[model samples]
Target chain A: MSTPRPLTLIVNGEPRALQVEPRTTLLDALRERLDLTGTKKGCDHGQCGACTLHVDGERVLACLTLAQQAEGRRITTIEGLAGPDGTLHAVQKAFLAEDAFQCGYCTPGQIMSAVACIREGHAGSAAEIREFMAGNLCRCGAYPHIVAAVQRAARALEQETLA
Target chain B: MMDFSYARPADLAAAGAALAAGGMALGGGTGLLDLAKLGVARPVAVVDLTRLPGLDAIQVSETEARIGALVKMSRLAAHPAMRAALPAVGQALLASASPQIRNMATIGGNLLQRTRCAYFRDAAVGSCNRRNPGSGCAAVGGVTRGHALLGVSPHCIATHPGDLAVALVAFDAVVETWSPNGQRLLSVHDFFLLPGATPGQEFALAPGEIVTGLRIPLAPVARQARYVKLRDRASYEFAAASLAAGMSLGVDGRIADLRLALGGVATIPWRARSVEAALIGEHPTPAAIAAAAALAMREAEPQPDNRHKLALVPALIERTLTDMVGEPA
Candidate 1:
C-alpha cells in the first residue's frame, strides 16, 4: 500500500486539490477523482491518445503521467475547451461542422488533440494534420473528417488572430 | 500495478542519493510507467528528474552539438537549428513516437527505453531472459518477426527499439553520464551492450549513474545525413527496418566518407562498419553499391519469421546509398 499525498493541480485555470496515491495516473485522477470524465481512457499505456490533454499548453497523454507530477502546471481537458458561457471552441465547432466523429467516444480527445495540433503549428496541410493527429486513434475511421475539422479550425483560428 | 513512493529531488546529488537507495530515476515516465503497469519493472520508489536545472539546454558550437538529456523530444525535433544542422537526428526524433508521447518523453529516456519484445513485456509469460534471468527466450521459436538478426544469442533476440540512438551511433556521438563516483563519457556505440548469456543487463551504465547528455561531432557526414524509417505505418509507428545513412563526396566525386547504422533490425544500434568500409574510396556505381550494401547482412542469422528482414536490410541499404548519391536505382 502507498500513502495518499496532497496534490494541487491547476486544471483549466483553477486549482483543484485532491489526495492521490503515488501510482494514480493523471487519467484516473481526472476521471475518477476530479469528476472530469470528459478525458476518456482508451489504452492506458500511452499507445492510444484518447486521454490526451494539455499540460502547460503542450499536449501529453494522461494515462502514462502520474497525477503527482502535474503539480503547478496549467492542465486543460476536453471539458474546459469551450467558453465559460458554453460556447464551443473553434475546434469543437469545426468538429461538429465537419462531423469528425461517428461513435463520438473519441470526440473529446480528438478535439483536444486537434486544438493542440493547430496551436503547435502542425495543421498547415492535410498530410501534416494526419501525421500530427495520428496519436489519437478512432476505431470508427473518422480520420478524413478529423483532418477536415482540423483544417477548418486552423483557418478559423488564423482569421481570428488576423481580426 | 505495484505501489511505490514518488519523490521530487532538488538536484542531481539528491536524485543520486534516492537512486542509490533503491529508487528509479523517472525521466518523462513514459517508458518506466508503462513497463510498471505491465509489472515488467517493479521499483520501490521513483525520483522525478524534471525539476533539476541545467540539464535541458541545447548547446551548439562550431565543432559539436551538445543535447541535454532532459530535453523533450518534441522541442528538440522542432528546434530550428537542430533541424537545419542535424536533420537525421531531428527526423529520427520526429519519426519515433506520437506527438503526445514526444511532448512528454525526454531524449535521455528515449535512448534508455526498453525493447518492445512481446514476451519481455508480459510478465505473465515465463520464458523471457531479459525480463527474468535464468529463463529462456520464448521469442525465438514463438514469434520471430520482430526479433533481432545481428546481435543475438541463444538467450535473447530482442530488438533495441529506438530511432535517435541509431542516427547518433552512425555519427560517432559520445554519451555523457554522471554518477556519485564521477562524471564520465563513452562512445554511444559502446554504451549499448550486446545481449549474451546475461541478457538482462542492457546498457553500460554504472550503478546509480544517469545519462546527462550527448555530444555529436559536426562533421561533413553529420551535416548531410538522413534517417529512412520503414515502418508498418506512416506516423506514430516503430521502424520495421530503418537506416540512418550519411555520405560525403570528394572533389573527384568518389565516396570520401560514409557512415551507416541500422535500427529495429538488431539487438543494439548496429553500426554497419563493413558497409561503410567497402563504400569508401569507390566511385558511386550501381554494381559497387549493391555489393557493398549486401555486406551489411554478412553475419545476420535470421529466424523463420524474420527472414524477410534478411532481404529488407540490403535493399534498404542500397536505396539509402542511391539516395545519398542523388540518383534513381
Candidate 2:
C-alpha cells in the first residue's frame, strides 16, 4: 500500500483537508472520514445509486470516484441539501409531502437524485422523471410516490424561478 | 480492492511515460473502480489522464466532429451540436447505463469497457476464457442468455457491453490514440477484437497507448439515424438485442446511403455491411427491410440459450429501418 496522501476537498461548502490512503473512495471519505453517513453504501459498486452525490454539480456515483480524483472539486452530499438557515430544500419538502419513502433506506439517494433530475430538466413529465431517476433504486417499492414528489418539486422550482 | 498509487499527469507526454512504466491510464474511473472492487482489475498504479490538456474537447463542424476521448458520456449525449448533427450518437449514449453512470464514464473508457458476461465478472467461476485465457468457458453450456451470437468461438463468447461503440462503428468513426510512437488513427471496426483463441486480447490499443480523441465523418445518413434497444427493463439495463440504423433517402424515397450495426449480440460492435448493401438504392418496404435484416445475421452462430437473439436482431433492424423511413417524431 502507498503512504497516505494529503488531500483537500470542498465538501458541503467547506474546505476539508485530510490524509487518506490511495484506495479510499470518495464515498468512504464522506461516510467514514467526515462522518457524513447520509450517503448509504448499497452495492459498493457502480450499479447501485445509493451513494449518489454532486461533484461539481454533476450527479455521479461516489463509490466509483476515488478520493484523489475529487481533489479541488465541490462535493455536495444529502446533508448539504438544506438551506443554511435550517429550511429544507424544495425537493426534500416535496418528498416529505408526498410520503415518497418506505423503510427509508434509499431516501437520501432518491432525494439527491430527484433534486438533480429537476435541475437537469428531466422532470418535464412523470415518465421522463422516472426515466431520469432510474439510477436510484428503492427495494421498498416507493417509485410511484417518488415520481410524484419529483414532479411536484419540478413545478415548485419553476414557480420559484418565475417569482 | 487493491491499494495502488495514483498519478495525475499534467500532459500527454507525461501520461505516456507513466503508462509506459506499467501503469493503467485512468479516465473517469467509473469502469476501473468497479472492476477493482470486483477483484477483476488490480493495477500497480493508476495514471490519471483527465489533467492532460487537449483530450477533453468536443468539436463539431458541418462535415465532421472530433470528440476527445476524455469527454464524459453525459456531455456527449447532451451536446446540442452533436445531437443536431449525429442524433444516433446521442441516442446510443442515452440508451447506455444510467444517468449517474453516464455522468461519470468517459467515451474512451466506455469503448474499452469489459464485457458484462456473468462468467467473466465472477472470478470464482474459474471457466471464463476472457478472464483467464484457455481456462475454458462456462457460459457455453451454463447461463448464456446474455452471451454473444454474431461472433463466437469455442474459447470465448463474451459480448461487448458498450452502446456508443455500436453507433460509432456504423458511421466509420476513427479512434485517435497517442503513444511513444506519436499519434495513430484506427477505424472503429478494426479497433475492437473478436474473442477468438485470445479472448484476453480485447482491443487493439497497446499497453502504453492512450486514446486521445475520436473523429466521425458526417454524412446525410447520420442525421436520419435511430437507436432501438430491447432489454429486460426499460431503463438502466444492458440490451438484450439493440440495433442502430441510419440512412438518407433520395427525393424519390429510395435509400441513397445506409449504415447499420448491432449491439448486445456480438463479441464486438457488429457492422452489417451486407445489410447496408442490400438496402442502398432500394425502396425500403417492409418485405425488403426484413429480407435485408435476415442477410445481416446470416453468419451468426448462437449458443443454445441465446438462439433467440438470432430472431430478435433481425426484427429490431426491420423495425428501426422502417421507423427511419417515416417522418421524424
Candidate 3:
C-alpha cells in the first residue's frame, strides 16, 4: 500500500491533521475522517449544493475542494454556526419558523448559503435571493419557503442591529 | 476513483515545473475532479494551484483588465471592477451554473471544462471520440439536438460549453499562459480550436503550460455588449444556443463597429467575423442586423436534430443586438 498523504485542515474552528488519500475531497474529509457529517454528500459532484461551506468567509462547494488545499484556511461548516451555548443561528431560527424544508437533506447547505447571502447583502429582492441561492438544489421543491426564510432572517438581523 | 500524489505549488514557475515533472495541474478542479470521480481522468499525480500566490487577482485599468486564471467566477462576477469594466462578462458569469458552482469554478477551469455530451460522460458508451480517439462518435446519428451546427467535423460534433469565454472572445481577450519554457499569450479566439479531424486534442495549451491570466482589451463597444444564452432551463442547463455581441453605433444610428461571437452551436466559440464585417458602417435597423445574422448562419451545417438552431441563431442575434441598442432615438 502507498503512504497516505498528510493534510492539515481548519474545520469548524478546529485544526486537524490527518493522513488521507489524495482523492479525499474536503467534503469527504469533513464527513469521513473528521466525523463532521453535517455537510451532506448529495450528488458528490459540484452540481448539488449539499456540500456547500464557507472557506475564508466565501461560499464554496466543499465537494470539489481537495482536503490538502484547505491548509490554514478558516472553514465554517454548519456545525460552526451555533453559539457557544448551542443557541441556533439567526438563519437557522428563521428557517425553522418559515418551515423551509421537508426532507431536510439540503437544509444545512441552504441555511449556510442563506446566511452568506444576507451577510453579502444579496437579500434585497426575492428574485435576487432565488437567483443567488440557485446553486443549492432542494429537490423537495421548497424554494418559496426557503426564500421566505432568507428574507425573514435578513429582516430579523437588520432589526436586531437597529435595536 | 483512483488515488494519486498531490502537490501544492507556490507560484506559476513552481506550478509549471511541477507540471513538467509529470503532475497534472489542477485549477478549481470542478471539471477534473468530477471526471476523476467518474473514472475518466486518472492522472498519476496532481499539482494543486489553490495556494499559488498572485494568481487570483482581477486587475482592471483604463485599457484592460487582467483576470487571473484562478479567479473564481462568482468573485469575478461580483467584483465591482468587472461590473464597471465589462458588464457582459459579469452577465455571462451570472448566467452560468448556480452561485455555488460559480464560487468553486475558475475562469481557466471554465475554459477547459469538458463537454456535457451524455455519451462522453458515460465511459461504458465506448464510442465517444473525445474520450477514446478513433472510437466512432455516437453523437452523429444519435440524439444530436445538442450537437454542433458550426465547426462540426467527421470526428466530433461536441459544442464548446462556456458562456463567459464566448463573451471574452467577442471582447478580444488575450490568454496568458506559463510553461517550463517561458510565458506566452494567445488571443481567446485562437485558444479554442475546432476539432477538425482530431477531436482528442481540445485546447491549444502545451502539456506543461498553465493559463495564468486573461487580458481583456477595454473597448467602448463593450459598454453596449450583451451575452444572451437560450436553454431548456433557466439555470444549471447548458446553452441550447447563445450569442455574445458587442457593438458601437455611430451618431446616425448606424453600426460603427461590431464583434459577434456564438456558443452552444459549434465545436469552438464561433466568432462571426463575416456578420461583424457586414454590420460595420451599416444602419442598426432590424433588417440590417437580420441580413448580417443570415450571413452568419449561411455556412451552418446542422445535424438533423439541431436544424432548429439555424432559425434560432438568427432570431437570438437580432433580439440580443436590439436589446443592446435599446429603443431607437
Ranking by DockQ: 1, 2, 3
lDDT (Cα, tens digit) per residue for candidate 3, span A29-114: 99999999999999987888998899988888888888877778999999999998999999999999999999999999998899
Supply every candidate's count of residue pairs whose N, Cα or C atoms clash at under 3 angstroms. 0, 0, 0
What DockQ does candidate 2 score?
Answer: 0.88
Q: Assess every candidate by TM-score.
A: 0.99, 0.98, 0.96
- Candidate 3 chain A, poorest ten consecutive residues by summed lDDT: A1-10
- Per-residue lDDT of candidate 2, residues A31-82 (tens digit): 9999999999999988879999999998999999999999999999998999
Q: What is the Cα-based lDDT of residue B214 in candidate 1? A: 91
Question: Model 2, B1-329: lDDT tens per residue?
Answer: 88899899998888888898899878888888888888888778999887788778999999999999989999999999999889989999999888999998899888889999988888678888888778899998888899988888889889888899999998999999998899999998889998879999998988789998999999878888878889999999998988788888888988899899899999999998999998899999988999999997789887888888778888888888877677653
Chain A TM-score of each candidate structure, as shown? 0.98, 0.98, 0.96
Native interface contact recovery, model 3:
0.72
Each candidate's lDDT (Cα)?
0.91, 0.89, 0.86
Task: Name the candidate, 1 or 3, with the larger DockQ value.
Answer: 1
Reference-based lDDT, residue B209, model 3: 90
True-contact fraction per candidate equals: 0.88, 0.88, 0.72
Name every residue pair that clashes in candidate 1.
none
